[model samples]
Target: MKKKPKLLKKNEGLNPAAAAPKIEPIVVPINKALAIRVVLMAGLVVLKT
Candidate 1:
């Protein structure tokens, strides 16, 4: 028995792994940044009231 997809080479391009994987930098300062974000959001909300 013959499977359908095997008949086409076009399907290989659709596989995510076949494309270049996105490499993101690991930001080590995320905790400090998150703290700053929370403080800023809190200040904004408090001042808006």
Candidate 2:
């Protein structure tokens, strides 16, 4: 029973480490999309002027 708890703790620690990479990829694309949208908006404003 003690060993099982230890294994669970180790898995819990690794879970976040594993999940972080997955989350980062998602965030990067979102940032890239936002950047593209900002650039497009700036271009539109400049063209209007």
Candidate 3:
């Protein structure tokens, strides 16, 4: 049996990319305190994943 092809609405085809969150570049801090926090958070994320 053959199934019919789906027809997308005006924005349906492009909606997924548009709906996704945009990623911003991460800026590293020169300050020691802020840098440590960022490193810890990144390490935790890596371990979790």
Regions of model 2 farther than 4 Å from truth:
1-19
lDDT by residue for model 1 (1-49), tens = 3676664435655664643242123344666788899999999999999
CA shift of 16, model 2, Å: 7.3
All candidates in order of TM-score, best leading: 2, 1, 3
Most accurate candidate by lDDT: 2
User: Candidate 3: worst 10 consecutive residues by lDDT?
Assistant: 20-29
For candidate 3, what is the TM-score? 0.37
User: What is the C-alpha local distance difference test score of each model?
Assistant: 0.63, 0.88, 0.56
Expressed as tens digits, the lDDT of each residue in 1-49 for candidate 2 is 7799998867766899866776788989999999999999999999999
RMSD of 1: 9.3
Q: What TM-score does candidate 2 get on C-alpha atoms?
A: 0.58
In terms of TM-score, how similar is model 1 to the real structure? 0.43
Task: Please give the lDDT score at residue 20 for candidate 3.
Answer: 38
Judged by TM-score relative to the true structure, which candidate is superior, 1 or 3?
1
How much lDDT does candidate 1 score? 0.63
Looking at model 3, the pairs that clash are none
Error of 1 at 22 (Å): 19
